[model samples]
Target: MPRSQPAIPICPPFPISGILRAARRRSDLSQRELARAAKVSAATVGRSESGTILPSINTFATLLAAAGFFLAVVDPDGNVLQPMKTRDDLRDGAERLYPAHLDVIPDPEPGEWWADIYGLARPPETFYRDRRRRDYQRRLSQWQVRVSKHRHLPEPRLHHYRDAP
Candidate 1:
């Protein structure tokens, strides 16, 4: 018998321009029509469909909505990714579980990118549950001392030394 190889999952390519054009065409809408319905300039729609410019998610969603289409985050096999809003999905066969307070969407700090999404909401960068808090503090303090001393003489000379003119 011949040996069979396991199938590897292939990632689906997201061709923005092609998708936009196809969706628009499917609705029989021209760039101008799509733009008008989306409340954007015709040039923007044309550029997006032609691949000359990349449209923001907001604008793209607007256009898709106008064309009776929708923008959805999907995985390789077209499975919708994270489709449920944390606030709305409370025990609707969800795979992830969290306490009520922690279940809702969290507000990210200013200049911070999607804090909760990146796990930044849990703790500071230096914190890890496996490491003892005291040990981490000691190491951090030592690091600070080394960093501060680094700007000073790399090596101190106890022997007599003179600066040359």
Candidate 2:
């Protein structure tokens, strides 16, 4: 058998200091001029270019804007990723933001949800358990119907849950 080589992990470029310096030079802006434009101190701009301290996202964006540049996030294939819009209206009973991974369904039908068995009126919007649980329950119910019609028990289908980031 031939020996296999280990896969090398790919790292994205992150030369922020170099990028800032280049952008400032390209825009013909001195450190003090850039600082004044960005509403930050000249020392802060110098320290950022020298990599003495890393700026926050907002600060970095501001600095870039002052140097006539803008920051953007792109995928490996160079596709720009837009930020998700904030949903101010949707909220749980405790007014906490729902997990982004879960799907939010609006106005579920009666007895269509597991929580409906409590006899309380359904909320206007809600999120259920992961899809695996719902799929398993649906398949199990169908299997039960088949078993009743054939007068014999059969192995039921199974589902697996996928964890979300």
- Candidates' C-alpha lDDT: 0.63, 0.80
**Model 1 — TM-score against the truth?**
0.45
Candidate 1 Cα outliers beyond 4 Å, as residue runs = 1-13, 87-165
Q: Per-residue lDDT for 149 in model 1?
A: 56
For candidate 1, give the lDDT.
0.63
| Ten contiguous residues with the weakest lDDT in model 1 | 123-132
Off by over 4 Å in 2: 1-13, 110-112, 117-120, 131-165
lDDT of 2 by residue, 58-88 (tens): 9899999988899998877889989876587
For model 1, which pairs clash? none
What are the per-residue Cα lDDT tens digits for candidate 1 across 71-94?
777767789877544533333235
Model 2: lDDT equals 0.80
